[model samples]
Target: MKITKQNIRTALWVTLSVLLVTLLLQNSANVNLRFLHLRAQMPLFAVIMLSALFGAGILWFARRRR
Candidate 1:
């Protein structure tokens, strides 16, 4: 199978879309970490969205040469 720009773009879109939906459904969940007595509660949706955006940007930059 040959990999192409269109294939990559489509995969990225699908992945991001799935992440977005998953986050939306699990927005109320809270994650806890214990380190030096520091606790943080964050919205999962925001994290997923940001991650997806960053991934998209990186993918675009990496593929610009092709």
Candidate 2:
């Protein structure tokens, strides 16, 4: 199989989507997040997705500045 930039990007996106779906389906329990003096309760999937998005955003921002 030939590997190209588009192919690599597509593969990564498909892999991430599969992982996200698997995690969402397997995690159904509610989770509590404590940050310093703050607290919040949300579904495990939501928390995971939010954290992933936050991390991605930080990476994108850092990359853009370089």
Candidate 3:
């Protein structure tokens, strides 16, 4: 196949995805978290994903409000 910008972008994305999965797998350990009166334990990756979603939700809400 001929080399193209789109192909390169797709390859990069696939590589990054593989790397991300590897990283998550490597960090398969529970962590303790507390928020105000709430407390829980979860895997590192789950905590990160939840934080990202929370940030994105806040950002989206702020942008929509403006």
Report the number of the highest-TM-score candidate.
2
lDDT per residue (tens digit) for residues 1-66 in model 1: 689999999999799788778777878655554458777666666666666789889999999968
Poorest 10 consecutive residues by lDDT, candidate 2: 19-28
Q: Between which residue pairs do clashes occur in model 2?
A: none
Evaluation by TM-score, superior candidate among 1 and 2: 2
Write out the backbone clash pairs for model 1. none
Models 1 onward score TM values of 0.47, 0.85, 0.63
Better of 1 and 3 by TM-score: 3
- Tell me each candidate's RMSD, in Å, in order: 5.5, 1.5, 3.9
Residues 1-66, candidate 3, lDDT per residue (tens digit)?
999999999999799778767877787799999999999999998887677579879999999999
> What residue runs in model 1 are displaced by over 4 Å at the alpha carbon?
1-19, 30-41
lDDT of 2 by residue, 4-56 (tens): 99999999999999999999889879999999999999999999888889999
Could you tell me the TM-score of candidate 2? Answer: 0.85
**What lDDT score is found at residue 41 in candidate 3?**
95
